[model samples]
Target: MKGLLPPPGAVRLLSIGGLVRTTGFGIMTSISVLYFTRSVGLSAAQVGIGLTIAGGCGIAASVISGRVADAVGARNTAITLVLIQSLAVCGYAFVTSFTGFVIAVSVVLSCHSAAEAARGALVAGLIPAEGRVRARAYLHSVTNAGLSIGAVSGGVALQADTQGVYVGLILACGALFASSGLLYMLLPQVEPVAAPSGRGSWEVWRDRPFLLFAGLNAILAANDTVLVVVLPIWIAQQTEAPLAVFSVVLIFNTLMVVLFQVRASKTTSDIPGGARAMRRSGVLFAVCFALWAFASGQPAWLAVVALLAGAVVHTLGELLWGAGAWTLAYEMAPDHAQGQYQGVFTMSTQLETMVMPVAGTMLILPAGSLGWLLFALLLLVAGLAAPAVARRHTNRHTNRQGTPSWN
Candidate 1:
C-alpha cells in the first residue's frame, strides 16, 4: 500500500472547504423550523411537508450531480452547485408564502446535496487510495467544528429578527460559495479517468463485498438518523433535563470529532482490513445503545452521565466506520469507474435519510423496547457478518489468481 498520508496541500484545501460548507449548512438548518413557521407563516404540518419534499428532491439531485461530476469534472460541478446554492439561500429572503418558502428551501437543499456528492467524488479523485479515509476524516473533523460554531451563532442570529436571520444565512451561503471557488483553484486539475469498456452502473453489483458494504452502511446510516432525531425526543420525554442539555451532548459529540477524528484516522490507516475496523465499530455501537437504554432508568444527573458516555462510544464508532467505509469504497472501485461507484456509495446515505423517519417512528411506538432491541440485533448481525464476508471475498480473489492466501 502507498503511504497513508494525503498531499499536504490537498488536505488543507479540502478541509477548509468542508469547514465552510458545513458551517453554512449548520447555520441554516439550526433555524429552518422557526424561520418557516414564523417568517413564512407556515403551519407545522406545512413545514414538515416542505421538509419531506426537500429531502426527496435532494436525494434525486445528489444522484444526478454524480453523473454531472463525471461529465463536467468534479471541481466544475462543485463550483456550479455551490453557486446555485448560494443564490437559493439569498432567495429565502424573498419567501413570503408557504409555497415560495418550500420552493426556495427545496432548491437550496437539492443544491447542497448535489454539492456534497461532488465534493466526495472530488476528494476520492484527488487523494491517494491509501490516504483517502484519513483525508475524509480530516474533512469530517473540520466540518463538525464548523457546525458547532455555526449552530451556536445561528441561535444568536435568530434572537435579532426575521430579517436578521435571513441576512445571516445569506452571508453564510456567500462565504461557502466563495470558499468553494477558492478550493477549486487550489485543487489540481486532473482529467477524469477513461470509462471502462462496456462498464455501467449495473457492473458495480458484481462486486459482492461492495454490495455488502453498502447494505451495512445503510443500517449504520439509519442509526445516525436515530442519534440526531430520536435521541433528543427520547431525552425530552423521559427526563426533567432542559432541551439545552441535549445541545450540550451534541457539543460534546462535535468536540470529540474535532479533536480526535484525525487521530482515529491515523490509527485505522494501517489496518489494511476494513472489515476488522467495522466489526470493532459495531461492537462499540452496541455498547452505546446499551448505555442509552440504561440512561432511561437513571436520574437526571446520571442520565447526563450516561448520555455523555454513550456519546463518546457513538463518536468512536463514527470515526471507525467513517474511515473504514471510505477506504473500502476507494479500494473496491475499479480505476475507470470511480465516479459511478462513488455515486452508488453516496446513495446509501440518501437511502438512510429516507429510512430515518420511519425507523424513528417505529422505535418510539408502543413496542419501543422491541424496536430498540431489533435495531441492536441488526447492528450486531452486520458487525459479525462483515469480517466473514471480507475474509471470503479476499480468499475468492486469491483463488482466482491461483494463489494460496490467508485473508
Candidate 2:
C-alpha cells in the first residue's frame, strides 16, 4: 500500500481478484498431478500428455478469445472466463477417468489462459499508459503473496493425505475462482477501443516483430521453470544437501517477488530501461546457475551454502526479468489491440512452461557442471539478444510515429 501500486480503484480491484485466482491456482498446482496419479489412477504419462495437449489447445483459445475480448469488452470477457474457470475447476472433483480428466483440463486451461489475456487487456484499457507496468507488477506481487499462502494451505492438506482433504482443496479452489469472478463483475468496464477497421486475428498473426519478441521472451521465461522444476531434481539427486533446503529456495523466491518486484519495475518503467534490465537479468541468471552447478557433488554443508547463495542470486534475476518483461509487454502493444497482443504474449509463457521442464532437466542435469555452464551461455545469448531486439522495435515505432512510442 505504501509503495508504487496504483491507488485503490480498478487497479486494486483487479489485483485482489488476481490474488484470489492465483491462490486457487497455486493450491491446485501443488497437488493436481499427485491427485491424478494416486486418486484417479492415471499414469504419469497420461497426465503429462493430457496437460500438454490441454495447454496446446489453450494457446489457440487464447488467440481467439483476445478478439472476443476486444469485441465484447475486456472486463466482461474476463468475468465470463473466470466464471467458466470456476465451473471447470470444480468439475475436476467428479472426473473418474482419463477422458473426463482431459476434458476438465482442457476447459480449465483454456478458460484461465484466455481470462488472463482479457484481464491484461482490461488493465491496459483502464489504467493510464504510464501506470500499466506498475499496475501489472503490483498484481504480480499480489500473485506471489497469494501463492505463498495457498502453498502453505496445500502443504497441510498434503500432509493430512485424506480424500476429504483433497476434495476440500479442489472445492476451495473453485470457490475462490467464483469469488474472483464476482469481484471482476463489480469492476467498471472501460469503453472498448476498436481495432483498425477490417483488422482481426490475422493481423495479429502477421506481426512478425512481435512474434519474434514473444518467442525471445518465452526463452527467457524458462528461467522461471528452472527455479521450480529443475532445481529440486538437482538438489535431490545431484547434491548432498537435505531436500528440505528446497523449501528455502521457494520461500526465498516468493519473498523476493513480493517485496521487490514493484521496486524493480520502477527502474524499468520504460522500454529502453526494460531492455537494459533484461540484459542484466541474463547475466544474473548465468551466474546463479553457474553457482548451482558448483553446488553439485559438494559436501552437504557446502552444497547447502551454495544452493542458498545461488537461490538469492537467481531471485535477483527473476525480479529483473519479470519487471522488464511486464514493461516490454505493455509498451510494445498497440492501444487498440492490447487484447490480441496480450494473448499472443501469453502464448510465449505457455510455450515456455510446456517445453522448459524437459529441456532444463535433460540439458542441465545430465552433463552436470558442463551442462550448467552451457545453460549459462544460453542465458547470456538471450540476454544479449534482448536489448537489440527491443531497440529494433523501438526504432520501428519511431519510424512509424515520428517519435518513440513508449515514451
Candidate 3:
C-alpha cells in the first residue's frame, strides 16, 4: 500500500513548499493593484501595460525553462529559479519609476514561470505515473486553501492601508519564497528523462497535432477567466439574482474545486479518458451557459434559482475540465521532455488569460442573451472537436512507439 503512493517525505516537502509559496502570493494578489496605484503612484494604464508585458515575458520563459530543465535537471532548475524569484519579489518593494517597475515585473514573472515549469517536471519525475494526476489534484486543493488564507490576510492589509503593512507583506512573501527554495533544495534530485530518439525542443513545435491540442486547451481554459471576469458582470446586468449571489458563486466554485477535484481526476487516467472528460465538461459548460442566458430578465426568485443551478453545473464542468486538462497535459508530453512539453502546454493558460477578458466580455456583454447563446455554441463545438483531435494525434504517433504515453 505504501509503495503505491509517492514517498511520504517527498509528498510532505512538496505540500509544505506549495502551501507557503501560494499563501504568500495570495496575500499580495488581493491588494497588488492598490499597491501599484496608491503606494507606487502608477496610473491604471501603466499598471496594465506593466502586467501585460510581464505576462508575455513569463509565458516565453516557461518554454525556455523547459529546455533548461532538459539540459540540466528539473530539481536543480526549480530550486535556482525559486531563489532568483524570491530576490526579484523583494525588489518589487523598492521600485518607484515605471521603468524600474517593468524591469522588476519582468524578472519576477520570468523566474516564477520557469520555477513553475521545472517544479511540474520534477513532480512528474518523482511521483509514479499512476499517482501523478492524483498528486496534482491534491496540490491544486492545497493551493486554493492557501489562496483563501492569503486573500484574507491581504484584505486585512488593504484595510490597514499602512506603509509598513504593504512593505512587510512584500518582504514576507519573498522570505516565504526563499524558504520554499530551501525546501526544494533538500529534495532528492530527479534525472531528466531524455527523449529516446534525442529529439530537440523544436520537435514539439513541429508536432502539428500536439500544437492543435495545446491550442484547444487554451480555448477551453478560458472557462476560468469567464468565471472571474464575466460572471459577476453578467449576474449584475443580465440576471435578477441578488448582488450577494456573486460572492456565493465565488465560494461555490472554490469549495467545489477543493472538495471534488481529486474525485474528478480519478476518472481520467490516460489521454483518451482525459479527452472524454474534457468533452463532457464542454457539454456541461454549454448547458450551464444556456441556463445563464435564460436568467436574463427573469423574475428575481426564478433568476436566483436559475443562477444557482447554473453555478452548480458550471462548477461541475470546471472540476472535470481542470482534471482532464491536467492529465492530458502531463500524459501527452514526451517523457524525456516533460518539462518543455508542460511548459508549452501552460502557454494555453497564459494565452487564455491574456485574450479572454476582453474577448469574452465583448462576446457576452454586448448582445445580451444572444451573446451567451453564441458563446455556448462555441464551447459545444470545441467540446465535440476535442476527442477527434486526440484520436488523430494518437493514430499519427503510435506507430513507432515513440509516442507520448496516454497511460
Measured by TM-score, how close is model 2 to the native structure? 0.94
Q: Candidate 2 at residue 369, lDDT?
A: 86
Model 3 spans > 4 angstroms off: 1-7, 399-407
Give Cα-based local distance difference scores for all models. 0.73, 0.85, 0.81
TM-score of 1: 0.89
Which 10-residue window in model 1 sums to the lowest lDDT?
398-407
lDDT of 3 at 202: 62
lDDT tens string, model 3, 1-407?
Answer: 33222347776688778878888778867777788789999999998899889889989999888778877889999889988988988898998989998998888888877777887788788888777788778777777877888998999778888777788899998998889889987789888765676565566787777788788778778778887898889988778888898798889888878777778889998878888888988898889888888888999999888888889999998888888878877877777888887788777667877788888788788888888888888877777777778878788765635443433
Clashes of each: 0, 0, 1
Q: What tens-digit string does per-residue lDDT give for candidate 1 at 1-407?
A: 12322346987787777777778777887877887677767899998888888888887787678777776688777778888887788787778888897899899889888877787778777887777777888887787877877788788888876756666676666677666666677788745777767766445668777788778877766667878887888777765456677777777777777777766766554324676677777887787877776677578888888877888888888877777667666766666556556766777767778777776766543345455666777777776676666665655555334342224
Each prediction's TM-score versus the true structure: 0.89, 0.94, 0.94
lDDT, model 2 = 0.85
Q: Rank order by lDDT, top first?
A: 2, 3, 1
Off by over 4 Å in 2: 4-6, 197-200, 399-407
* lDDT (tens digit, per residue) of candidate 2 on 83-172: 999999989889899999999999999998999888888889898988888888888899898887887778878987766788889999
